[model samples]
Target: METHDSLLARIAPAPGQCSRTILDPATGTPVGEAPVHTVEDLEAAVAAAAAAQPAWAALGHDARSAALLKAADAVERSAEELARLLSREQGKPLNGPNARFEVGACAAWLRATATTPLDPETVVDDGETRAELHYRPIGVVGAIGPWNWPMMITTWQIAPALRMGNTVVVKPSEYTPLSVLALTAVINEELPEGLLTVISGGPDVGEALASHPAIGKVMFTGSTATGKAIIRSSADTVKRLTLELGGNDAGIVLPDADPKAIAQDLFWGAFINTGQTCAALKRLYVHDSLYDAVCEELAAVAAAMPMGNGLDENNVLGPLQNQQQYDILARLVDAARDAGARILLGGNPDPGQPGNFYPTTLVADIDNNNPLVTEEQFGPALPIIRYTTIDQAIAMANALDVGLGASVWSPDVSAAREVAARLQAGTVWINKHGAVDPRIPFGGAKQSGYGLEFGTEGLKALGQPQIINGWTATQTRATPN
Candidate 1:
């Protein structure tokens, strides 16, 4: 098998002293050379997509659905190799929770999107007059995906866009571009050339894709700051956008909840993907009656989970995917400690550690005002805040600039759902957290970002709405300028 480095070098720009090396976060070893693309590269890709989208869309829904399903099959066939590459590049453990699952999710999403129907609806019918609403493809879609869950999130953007008949030009994160490139190769076998192009680079490439005049829609999944930048860049073109940005999600533990039963679920909810998830539970607000018990239970679970390199089968949690995130998390933990929050578990990074590994940390008695609780610490550290009343907990949770996801934990399903309805988030869970489905729409509210990502609403977001109206000969028609 050709090495990842060699595979990437074939498509990369001419070898230069300035070429950026993609480091394997697990070992800090150079795994691939990411292409440094210019505005020309982005323009060429967008132009190709602009030319290809009409024919692809003209093939109609059935043909497009068949191609997507075939692409899904190709992805499944190469799942193992892709999963291995993903673990090496993204620092997600291959066997345990999410690395393999992420790769498999790409295939699953493609299949689901391939079959999700988008039939024309008869909006009005009054015997003599009738009207129908149609969903038509919106030219080329520019997809800028994040590094965490690289392949799955990329598919989350492209699959629906393609299913809705829009050709795509994707720019994956430079840190983990190879897996997306590899997955694109598999997909291209079933898709038409230029229908799904992968261009890898830093901000320059992303900026070009977002602002390109040929691109009709931009689908982005990243930090709120970057999402805002894309919105501004695309503003001149008045491009359609579907932005899935950051989230500092809060998970509340009601006084009636059982800490022991919910401990394992809560721990994984916050720490999945090594707590590098944008929608992971960053803050936990527990009722004072159950706060201490919840803290101890959560601490015990965190202590038991193994954290190490992604290749190790025994390790469920891997290192932070990059140094920047590691530093941010470390600073947040330090601030929490200085603010008088009690550290119930791991709080420091091991200087001797080979990778960017911050231990699974739990800080208790922190207030909502603490930076650790307020900011989206996309790492392994979680702050546990104490709340005296349910209203206080809900208020504290909703105080942040972000409102992506929130959850309520209680034994009474009815009571839990009542509180869930009050939480200001795109998706509120009764017991679980961050369990999103393709059949349901998922997007952020407020500064978190806008536009849904899945389901009928999301599918339609990628297309333009066209309405056809007809009247009987009995109705008089007037010509208007």
Candidate 2:
């Protein structure tokens, strides 16, 4: 029953604590004040989670799953309030696959994680020997989330961790802490105290969390640089790490694809969340036969999508979440322009604009090695590169060090799948891009990240594995004889 203001007030910083005011990215106005917890606060939270984990784990899988189901219901009950807060704090629109979609995804992931079965597996069952593999809770898990898709990604980390019987301490990004705090507040209503906590702190707190001896695992989703830092910090403790790092995902359109038919999906795949997603298509490779037609159709789609204040229901696309991101996008686009890339739809923005509103830009006829193509421009701008053959497209897609996700678009599913297999990424789609399902396992390859997330494999990643090996009844009987 909480309204948007009531929800913000509920998670507001307590009196006398250091706090920072989060601003609406669309208007640069105040959204809410988030508590700035320190390293000491993070240590205390980890300690509390370690203390509370034993009893929570002892409740058994069924009991823990039932609790998660309740938490999912709690999320659904306050969906609207949470969506509004997320929209304002993250600068994603209220409709589309933005605010409301993110909130819904949270609830769906919770339910999926709660219900996905992960029973102990019998690895060996001969007459002379029997062995079963089981997963036990990893005392306390540290979840470091990104500003983009804050609530949904937070749930992606915590739901499976909690379901696997681990208590979680979350550290949201400095840019969007209010959304995470508000989300945790709603889920905590159905759980025991200290089982989950959010430490809205800076890098020092994150470093402490990664290195803290009490934490058994850390789930991080952010840039490659930060992921590498976490790896170094956790080396001493050897903490289990699941890192979904930066991705410059590429999409390949075969010669046979109907440009107009696939235009809308391609546009959203890149521009969703204003192109801030880690797995969104950043650079595209189109066969030379279809390049011009595809570019025209994509430009038409991007031009029609409204970009403005998130609060306005009519606007499906909003501003960049922060000034830093806007500046990065502007610089990359300018560089592309100077390099003689064709600006198909938009490449210009008014400097006088109040918010960080970079126009939905599509740079065509760009070189494969341009900064806009090679770098991760995590904004609403995509570069289209032309390829003469399938081998060239595959080579271009696999050239990057980071391979989180990729896609191959064609009318022939068989042909697309063949090309998809050649791409170097954790997951690849045929004719669609960035359509992640909770039931499927998602992760990164090479420098993108090491661990897998989602589905049963994801649940297993959050826990410790043990093999229960012993003699079978036949062996005991023979020994007695």
Off by over 4 Å in 2: 476-481
Which 10-residue span in candidate 2 carries the lowest summed lDDT? 472-481
lDDT of 1 by residue, 1-481 (tens): 5444444555565656235677888788877666666667778888899888889999988999999999999888878778877888899998766788998899989998988888899989887788999999999999999989899999999999998889999999977888888889878989988899988767888998889888899999999999989999999999999888899999999999999999999998899999988788889999999888999999999999999888788889998999999999999999999989999999978898787889999998887899998888999999999999999999999998899999999999999998988888988988888988888999988888999988888899999999999886688677898
Total colliding residue pairs, candidate 2: 0
Looking at model 2, the pairs that clash are: none
Model 1's lDDT to the true fold? 0.88
Candidate 2 per-residue lDDT over residues 1-481, each given as its tens digit: 7898999899988999999999998898999899999999998898899999999999988999999999999999999999999999999999999999999999999999999999999999877888999999999999999999999999999999999999999999999999999999999999999999999999999999999999999999999999999999999999999999999999999999999999999999999999999999999999999899999999999999999999899999999999999999999999999999999978889888888899999999999999999999999999999999999999999998999999999999999999988889999988888999989999998899989999999999998999999996557544553
Query: Model 2, residue 443: what's the lDDT?
Result: 95
Which candidate has the highest lDDT of all?
A: 2
Please state every model's RMSD to the true fold in angstroms. 1.9, 1.7
